[model samples]
Target: MVEEAARRDLAAIAITDHDVVGGIAEAQQAGQRFGVEVVPGIELTAEWDGRLAHILGYFIDPAHPELVVGLERAREQMAAHVRDVLDAARALGVEIDEAALARYRGRYVSGATLVLGMLEQGILRGSPHARQLLLRASREPRPFSAAEAIALIHAAGGVASLAHPVKLRRSEPLLPARTFAPLVAAGLDGIEAWQIVQGPTVRDHYRRVAEALGLVATGGSDCHGPRSVGMRLGTQRVPAAVLSAMKQCWRDRRRALPDRTGSPR
Candidate 1:
């Protein structure tokens, strides 16, 4: 990921892996080596209206006590969820090597990885049965509420942004935008106005909402790796001003707080 971003001449990039901070340190080291600024980030799952909404925290202090505590809690919940999925797959006659998965003891097991593994083993091929089982298994433990997630990000001296609000699966048009008010009040600092797979119309809608709500507009490719379909690094060039604005917001928030031990800058 580091090499690809550097090759694309991106000024900076964030490593926002799910429920883990373990990869940030290594990415930071590689960024320094490659002359690319690395923003420590994490993608947190929060629940809103019975849906799992994603929040992206940028410029976070990876070692902040609050952040660490929250991540540990999330990790435990995710591990349980993954175990449940594995069990469900087994019940459905899908063979998953529990011993092999156990090797990633303290790391996150993303649903994509799990499903891809099954696909690689030729045991699953986008079948409705497999999809249904995995979907049911993955939602066992609900995540932190939106307010809680925003507070966690703020506690870590980072700016919290609504990640891919369009992907929230809300049926009502502008439901996400309507919910943004409470999120902003809860300390959301930005909105993802651009994304790799979002069409132009959707992107414009988000951008308009961000502008109207006085929120920072951010963009990202959300590229997982070289093999990520339709996700190309550097395709979404987030404005430099977005970073500046987020940094300023973080600083102001830190100054208003009683503690600054985890200030990212």
Candidate 2:
């Protein structure tokens, strides 16, 4: 990602991996070598009013104790969820390659990994079936609520932002402002107003919403990797001023917090 950012002439990029901060350190080091600024970030999956929401934490301390332990627990739950899915597949008489799955035992097990394993053994036909299985298997409860997620990010000295609101629900093109009120009240510092999937009108709508709620409007390409289809690094063309605003917000938040000596930090 850092290399891609440099190649694209992006001044900076945020590495916000889902439910983990493990990649930030390496990305930061690569950013130094590539002459691109890397923002330490994580995308946490949280529940909001019974629906799943993703929270992006920027400028986080990767080694924060609470964040580390919480993410570890979330990973364990994810592993257990994968086991349940495999068990369900077995009950349906699908043959799984246990040896292939074993490779992901000690690491984060994503639905894509499971689908690839199934594809390798010819157990799954194509994308449609893979998508069905993934959606069905992911109905389990999330580890944190939106409020808890924001609190965790704050505890780690990061700015918390709501990620991809337009993509949050397939049934609705855009969420109502009421849906964002609670999260904003919970200290959400920003909203992703610029996204690869949103059109200009929709992006403007979100930017307006963010402004009304007194939150910074941020943007990202939501790129996963170099080979990811239809997604390219730095495609959103986020302005440098967005980063400056986020940094100022982080600094203000830090200043508002009381230190161990009961003085403002």
User: Candidate 1 regions off by >4 Å?
Assistant: 99-107, 125-131, 138-140, 170-176, 261-265
Best by lDDT: 2
TM-scores, one per candidate: 0.87, 0.88
- Which tens-of-lDDT digit does each residue in 48-139 have in candidate 1? 66788888998888898999999888878877777778887777777776555433333556555565556555566766576786566545
Report model 2's TM-score to 2 decimal places: 0.88
Model 1, residue 76: distance off in Å is 1.3
Native-referenced Cα lDDT, model 1: 0.77
lDDT of 2 by residue, 1-265 (tens): 7887898999999989889888888989998899999999999989987788999999888898999998988888877877877887777666577668645322366555676567556776654456566565656548899999999998888899999898778788676677789898899999998889888987998888888888999989898765346447878899889888888888788778766121111
Reference-based lDDT, each prediction: 0.77, 0.81
Candidate 2 regions exceeding 4 Å error are 98-107, 116-121, 126-134, 258-265
